[model samples]
Target: MKLLKTDGIVIKKVDHSEADRSLTLFTKNFGKININISGIRKSKKRHLNGADLFGVSNFIFYKKEDYYILSSFELNETFFDLRKDLEKLNISFHILEILNSVLVENETRIGLYKLLLNSFRFLDKNNKPIKNYLLLGYFLLLLIQGEGIMFNINDGLYFDIENSIINDLPTFNKLTEIQKIIISNLFDKKINDIVSLDPSVDDAKSIILLLEDYMNYHLNLKINFKEFF
Candidate 1:
């Protein structure tokens, strides 16, 4: 009935038939939405495809019932660099999955949206080693903060392989005092301005595992961490 315009990232996509595909987008104005692009040309349709996964694009559509009927779109950034590395690709998908799972329809989360875009840009452009568990972990911390959920680094609670979460225990999975301090600093500092630190594989895994549990609990989501690995 009405035309809508917004900038969004393609978080998930599925082929509905040979002629059409559906996109799950995280937009700035609308939190999460599904838009369907119709009338496939078979050979010359990449532009309307919206740059595929993790791609940023501006869309114009008309609202029809529960979905946006895609009329036209302009490709912004496809983040093509992420496709070259499997680990980077997996991490980007995981971050997008977190956003898709935790965010709701028609709810505006500007902070989370910007963080997701910036995180992808950082990953795609930067030449750092694939030690980006901190990037993902910081997003979780920021999400918890944005939703007004109370979280403490020294809460002595974490996820267990056998159970979902453990709370009010002696220590958080044997994290050293210095490691805890570094993590707490991640929460205190701005995400863009923080000095990057090289956390070991074990350390990164622990932080992500802990954050997965924390975010799942707060968001009432049942997603697991094994998917990322």
Candidate 2:
């Protein structure tokens, strides 16, 4: 078995047998990995704390043919603040679910990693208004990386969700001008700097729905977070 060390965020954890766990982790160097973690609940272990949801860790693993065996882990960021509120946990889970479904193995996605880390930081700081911003930003980031959606900044035109660009107006007639501006600004602003700019809850919901349609049309993936709100 080949040994490897990498920084990873715990995406999901499922109880396997009596005392073992199957973890879905998104790593900085290795992308998504399936690792079996053991001896956490039964034995008196100190490092078992590293396996929490949204926990960032320095993981040492042994690569088998298909999956990796978690040998050791050093806890970095437990993101305990996110666990204090149900809303925060729900939002975090939604983001993690999207990443787990979209991102492929062995693909380097530094931008996505940074987005997740920054979102976690914002959640820790209790920045509620910007939650939708981060969510939309991550969706756009994934869309751009996967399909290369092009937009013309100068010419104000309709963005066809099916085509992933501002080419026609007739197809995307349902999208309003403000909605278009919101989508445009999502791509324009830096991920960390995205703010609501005095957006109402209803407006944010509309924008999220439009983005979901755009994503579905382009990437062919249905985001499950839409049902939550």
Candidate 3:
């Protein structure tokens, strides 16, 4: 009976009825939600792009009993360029997959939402493959931080995976020099300055893979990004 409006990005979509579709959106106020949109599949022209994955839009909906039914939507951004480049599209989906995996339904994560939007905007504008990987590393670090695991990368000697900190002595998880530098810079530098690090593709992947381990240990998320690489 109550109409609600919020800014959301489509993270998943699936065919429902012949004319309706089901979508999973990560909204600014409500976090992840599943809503059914009618007539989109049959009449694709009016609602197709707005309902597509990775498009940010303002959505209007209302709850009917237990289901949220879509009333309308206005597309804000499609991040169209991401669709043009295969690699960019792959990387973007990788980020989205992580988001879809970690986000609990109806739990608001304002910081993570902002980080996701900004990372998409950044990835949309930049064409450098290395920069894209660096952004992925940056996004992953922030995602971990959002979970309250602060990674202390000061002059990195050894990473304490158990405590999620960096220390002078060797720990069970040893980080390479390049991985240490990349992690430190990602946390310390601004978005514009990240590209200045200009890490090799391999180096960038090393940092991301290291962070992936942290994700598994701390968050219990096992994401295999091998296909994207």
Quote the RMSD, in angstroms, for model 1: 3.6
Give lDDT tens digits, candidate 2, residues 1-229: 6789999998989986788888888888888888987776575664665787888999999978877898888999887777787777777777886777677887877777777787787787775655644565556555555556544433445656655556445554355565555556666664343353554556556766665666666667778556665
Q: Which stretches of candidate 2 lie over 4 Å from their true place?
A: 130-135, 150-158, 190-196
Query: What lDDT score goes with residue 161 in model 3?
Result: 79
Number of the candidate with higher TM-score, 1 or 3: 3
- TM-score of structure candidate 2: 0.85
For residues 36-149, could you state the per-residue lDDT of candidate 3 as single tens digits?
988887884575889999889999999998889998999999988888989889889999888888899999988888888988898889978988988898888888878887
Per-residue lDDT of 1-67 in model 1, one digit per residue for the tens?
A: 6788999999988876676788888998988988887754353846754737788999888887766
* Local distance difference test scores for all models: 0.72, 0.70, 0.84
Query: For every model in order, what is the number of clashing pairs?
Result: 0, 0, 0
lDDT: which candidate is best?
A: 3
Clashing pairs in 2: none
Model 1 weakest 10-residue run by lDDT: 157-166
In candidate 2, position 216 carries an lDDT of 64
lDDT-best of 1 and 2:
1
Q: Which ten residues in a row have the lowest lDDT in candidate 2?
A: 190-199
